[model samples]
Target: MPDHPVPDPGRSLEGPLAPVTEEITAFDLPVTGTLPAELHGRYLRNGPNPLGLDDPVQHWFVGPGMVHGVRLRDGRAEWYRNRWVRSRQVAEALGERWAGGPVHAGMDFAANTHVIAHGGRTLATVEAGALPYELTDELETVGPCDFGGTLPGGYAAHTKLDRQTGDLHAVAYFWGWDHLQHVVVGPDGRVSSTTDVPVADGPMVHDFALTERYVVLLDLPVTFSMAAATAGSSLPYGWNPAHPARVGLLPREGTAREVRWSEVDPCWVFHTLNAYDDGDRVVVDLCRYGGSYDLSALSGQGPLTLDRWTVDPAAGRVGRQCLDDRPQELPRTDDRVVSRPHRYGYSVVTGEAGPATVRVDGSFADDAFTDALLKQDLATGRVEVHRFGRDAVVGEAVFAPSAPDAAEDDGYVLAFVHDPDRGATDLVVLAAQDFPGGPVARVHLPARVPLGFHGSWVPDR
Candidate 1:
């Protein structure tokens, strides 16, 4: 490990972006505009929230996980709640033991990064930690889930749900394990299969893609390093040029041995919007980075642009093209169109140097931050943007379907925006179809919600 000085925790865990100190529940949140009566659900987001004030390791992604959520019902802002995922590391740090019961061997739960509701349960998940922790609609931790002791490894933070099949698919990798496993959770919330895909090193597989017939696996060059791990580095993964950059097309119902690998230029993808099958090729849209791993600068030193990759299975090749050149991340689309072709997508526009900016090139300019939300019409190549100006920063925008059978883009784009001037956060709701217009409603919160990763909307049943 290269010799380096101690990092300042204030950079990642202080001020308007600071982590909440404790768990709290607030009732009847204040709203600025009228919330849609059809918008009834919880907008829950999860991210790293360090418990220790003087934490020795201060990497942005190294802290314990905390979730901030808001409840909406009958056009009224119901309540707000924030809670830690209660992993073993979090339990010990808080001087508490795991009251839930004995944990499974080799399970390390952080339950951060992303949260999703499926099969009648909400799972709080991280990429390489313990199994997902079950949470109630109110944000209470029920306990860890191993699919009833069937999951062989940790669950990936981003799992693709098949709308056609009602199945949950994930590509998971462990820190010390040489092979990654492709896990399938059935509609009944049980682990159906665990197929081990052998590889020489443990690469960080943050997210994957799914089409009508296959699961797309990204085996990039960011590999785990034992030197950095033992040297007290907060993030131990580094770029290995020797490792081949490739995309694996695995049959949805087959084992790992049936996967077909195709070579592509070296890159990293932290998240994907949507993917679909097109005759003999599979097209996937995602935010692509050029370099290896850097925890201090999660986006790395490359241009973080929205790109589309076309994978030709027979040719054993992958082609890429930039959809929009503006710097952006956290691309999302309507979940109802996931695993198939969709016409609309949404992303957060990152600016030069601001509070919520994930500097892709490791250089932070004075005024750089994510300043706007972007809406793209994939069918017509039309782009619309919603800017927040200079004093505010925006998080990922999740689309909530307007009705059970509404059109693909007929819904609201919900996100948390932190205003440094006001020193508070607001849940901004924008009409998905009216991207040129401003927010339909701004649900004000009692506290400032620190910038975090992915989130999901669970509509009231």
Candidate 2:
């Protein structure tokens, strides 16, 4: 993870992205190997543990298609709440014998089988529903917005709650144009009324953000060409930071039309994968500039220039906090990572990087966190880097509550680490305070996870 000048940015790729040589870094993150081995054959206690994870599914993290309830006590680990019997017979009985349990053939892009489990007990979940917007006004107020329209798919959301109180907050990204939509839910489930946020219109939308009391929206540039879909990415594109970013709002009892907007172009990348508030001010791990290095563009060169930023919403300031020398990977995978597919040692020398051979110049940040794991201290410009050795990489990561009060370094760090050596992926956990000290445990998964989007930490509620 040293320094290298980004691929010389020049020319156009309006037609096709040129194929080039790859040069990515590999990772050897904290490891715990196989699930059963690490579980010490204790696959008995199933379900997520608030204190951390346990057998069957070690570590308290869930990816798409999974949602849970959590409970956190100051200085203690989290625990899954409301869970019951982990019975396969129960699940099958629920569907076949009874009528409540749902059965689906498989999974994909559709929001078909969203599961909400409380301590292994079935709760409210959606397999085929739009974003969860309880119309009772129990959550944040919602209405059509004028900024990015419903056409761009409006926004994508992930929700979390305050354990003691059922106070809920959802952070999402506007798909029409990159904007942050923050929604808060009270005890009665009443949500804050909201209005459309304004920003430079673009081709696609990414993720949104939320702190305790704020909603941050980011507006960036994206491109559209059928070609992008074929490669699993959209590049040769650019970004647009409209002078000032805005967040629209309305109180619970008020009309959605009465929403008030706040201007806050977060500090860095308009589309951040994940972040939380730093006190009153909103802190975002930002991503800047993005384009393409079609070998066709440079005749024979490859893609490289990818940078990251840290934005302070209160002051509307942007900081170029870290520069992941690998520009190729940033625009696609950001700072939030768990793991990637494993690639054997010898295959690497043969120019075969397994699945990641998708591109050349190794994995670098084009417009996101790149392949490097970066965490920034906004108050002091301090940055920490967890290099994923070689083609080995973690996808998105979720934080374990360090304390009931939410101490910055009090919780644990849980992620899915991609082990190319074994051609598989594993769920890994690490004490946040003991970060680089290594893993507390690793649970080998029964299957391989392709590059994933967002994830959550559902501790004991």
Best by lDDT: 1
- Taking the tens digit of each residue's C-alpha lDDT, what string does model 2 give over 368-443? 2223454444345444555556656565454555434544555555555566677555566555555555566665
The per-residue C-alpha lDDT of model 1 at residue 329 equals 78
- Look at candidate 2 and tell me the lDDT of residue 344: 8
Clashing pairs in 1: 108-130, 300-360, 301-361, 352-368, 353-367, 353-368, 353-369, 354-368, 354-369
In order, candidate lDDTs are 0.79, 0.32
Candidate 1 C-alpha lDDT tens digits along 20-61? 665667788888888999998899999877666336434667
Clashes of each: 9, 85
* Candidate 2 worst ten-residue window by lDDT: 341-350
Model 1 lowest lDDT segment of ten: 1-10
TM accuracy, model 1: 0.92
Q: What TM-score goes with each of the models?
A: 0.92, 0.47
Task: Mark the regions of model 1 whose C-alpha exceeds 4 Å error after superposition.
Answer: 1-12, 95-97, 102-107, 254-257, 291-296, 352-368
